[model samples]
Target: MAAFNFTPSDTSLFILMGIPGLEAAHIWISIPFFTFYIISLLGNFTVVFVVGKEQSLHKPMYLLICMLALTDIGMSTSIVPKALFIFWFNLKGITVNGCLAQMFFLYAIAIMHSAILVTMAFDRYVAICSPLRYTTILTNARIAKLGLVGLTRAVFFILPEPLFLSRLPFCANQIIPHTYCDHIVVAKMSCGDITVSRLYGLVIAVIVIGFDLTLIGLSYGLIIRAVLRISSKKANLKALKTCTAHICVMLTAYTPILFSILTHRFGQGITPHIHIILANLCFIVPPMLNPIIYGVKTKELRDKVGKCRRSSLAATDFKPA
Candidate 1:
């Protein structure tokens, strides 16, 4: 833990501060984070449970939703537990290997979420614009292949970080300013020149988030045009309605991410805690809100959720005290 530490030893560690300048309020801030975790877990789990139990819910669209729910869970699980442990247990020091592991999962899962949203947009595009070809185009086998491709792509982009990071010389201080491990944040802590790391991260943001957003925008544009081409007003409305929840989820998922990235490189006037909070929100908000948005917008999911709830109630052993 000395200046210009050239290599990580068996005991080299990086300390994660829950939130700098607000140490006294760490526990207080953690309350809402904890709430988000619970709601996100239960809400996403319910989505999966309802979809699994109801045979009618077994479709390409619903299965994709289930994939999305699991991705949300992975995104949250990557950071929340360690963050909470830092807040509640004061266990801030993480080993080099541990920090690398966190960084890998955090980045990979977040990028995976973006990839899945893009897939969902494509699914809707096929279903709405080319209804007759939807099944043939997005078959069960094809979807599985797409899932594998997404998983592999995410890992490929993220695997380089820790590899190069392990070789970078660290400054005297090994403390990270936020709740979780971040690629750029950790890279900045290196005493060595980090030009390569910065550019690599920029390339990733461009290809993953920027490119995915472009695809999503184009898909929706075509979807809108296809809907307008429908002569029946009822059919047009139905098709558009099917996309509303997806649009909301996409906004929730990507808006904070874009804001954080833009602010990171250019927003010099922004406060550190504000940037960190927004970065955390990129993971927290969507997981907790995706199911709620979908359930509210889609009557089918809403009804199935209700039915599952009623069934659970009926099966409960309630008795007079």
Candidate 2:
């Protein structure tokens, strides 16, 4: 490692290119980027804060919503700040260790997001398909246990990524082609063999995200079957409506991710700028949209949000402002 041609010196740092061919438009790009960041932070935080304080929102479904909100916050915060720093200030130099830290947290939190969605799918599955036992099956204790398992699994799987990357020697270029550090991008920059890292990344992706997707599909399949058995069209619509928010969130979270993965692996002819844009979208779009989707689609949550807002407005009107 020490004798490698591209080994980092004492003042090692990786340069994060905001976007490959769109360097001149970084400031312009920051407009929407910052908007997404602010929305993600505000929306997700509101969900978590509102859910925590409202006693009525203490059930399994709401608990899962809170978990999802927290995951969105973590995912957005991990990558956005640094990305904005690069875009706004052109301060691209990130310490080798700093890059690894960002990569670990960003990827770890994303995995956690996937796991939370899977648990939420199960929550919906039980609620819709096994309504009689929904309460008994997903009690508060069980929700807490599921949350812990999701967090632990995310941490356990992603913890080794930084460690693995740290052992490999880096490029003298030290220029990452996107706004933030990615495990695959960083691994490719290494002078040492990246076959193991690549395989591990694929395995982790398949096992964690792929397996979760399979289960989510299965859960929804069972849910659809149960929904069909309802004789009343109105009742059937209502039951399916309950899942609208989660389905929207699933599409929001997974679509960009799958797009990026597919493009990266198979779309070799695609431009680098498009690839970078898609990569960033996977991180930004879901967090910014999940809370909005839930607040609008879930009637109970929307009512709570409206009540909370009215209370705040009244409190503000009574204040000395």
Candidate 3:
């Protein structure tokens, strides 16, 4: 197959290096990536399935969890399969349009995750601060609308990324150093000045991640105020405890992401392989851990999961051995 030559008239094919400087460990590294991908899919899907089936879990909080699960699945699926193919089979020729599509889905789902976290924070806020009006305020119709708004916000903001990226001429080398097509990596490959692309990317990042963090922080602030006002120490502790899982999930989702962004853009001293590893972790950790956190923290979800396990075991035992 002919590799894409730098020509003004044709689409460029980008080759993704799974991990540039650590090619020797590609196979070993792929093992953990594969494991995380599988766990992310199974864990998140179980959360969605269980939350969907259990009538008691038909509340705003669980509904948001379902949305988060779907986002996690989408985010991981967009990047990991291609990465695994590059790692396992050394097949890394991705067309320009294909790369744009992957970038679009990856960032869109990431923004959606941030939006879902904000909504989850709001849910906790209402449940804690205004318990009586919680159901009335966050009714099924309202939750669905919020979900739609979040999706629209993500899609609207992320749509321009691929559009702008597609227009840029890639006259330079078509090799991408990372496992997947990141916006920064792809944008910087263009022969022309990429100030517009870079600025737009930063603008979108701020609008999505920064805005969501602000809202989430505000929501938690109010929740804290409400918790502090409670007369009984046990009630206050209980209220604060409900937020622990969400806080952990939030940290897992954003901390690595922020670190990855900072290191990629400014950490000139950092090694390329380390930056790539952190980038991969930004996608992997939250999805793999979210369902486990919720399952362990929420008794209702834990009970339902246990029931599901027992039923499956019983069915297996009843079958012909």
Global lDDT of each candidate: 0.87, 0.88, 0.88
Segments in model 3 whose C-alpha atoms lie over 4 Å from true places = 1-10, 319-321
**Window of ten residues with lowest summed lDDT in model 2:** 1-10
Candidate 3, residues 1-321: lDDT per residue as tens digits? Answer: 323333434556787887999988889999999999999999998998888988988988888889999999998998899888887878877889999999999998898889889999999999999899988999977988999998998899999989988887886477889999999999988987789889999988887787889999999999988888899999999999999989989989999999888897799999999998999889988899999899888888899888888988998889674
In order of appearance, the predictions have TM-scores of 0.93, 0.95, 0.95
Better of 1 and 3 by TM-score: 3
Model 1 stretches astray by more than 4 angstroms: 1-11, 317-321
Least accurate 10 contiguous residues by lDDT in model 3 = 1-10
Rank all candidate structures by their lDDT, best first, as comma-separated numbers: 2, 3, 1
Q: Give the per-residue lDDT digits (tens) of candidate 1, residues 151-203.
A: 99999999888888888988767788999888888998888988888798789
Model 2, 165-245: lDDT tens digits are 899988666778989998898898888998889898889988987799999999999999999999999999999999999
When sorted by TM-score, best at the front, the candidate numbers are 3, 2, 1
* Clashing residue pair totals per candidate (backbone < 3 A): 0, 0, 0
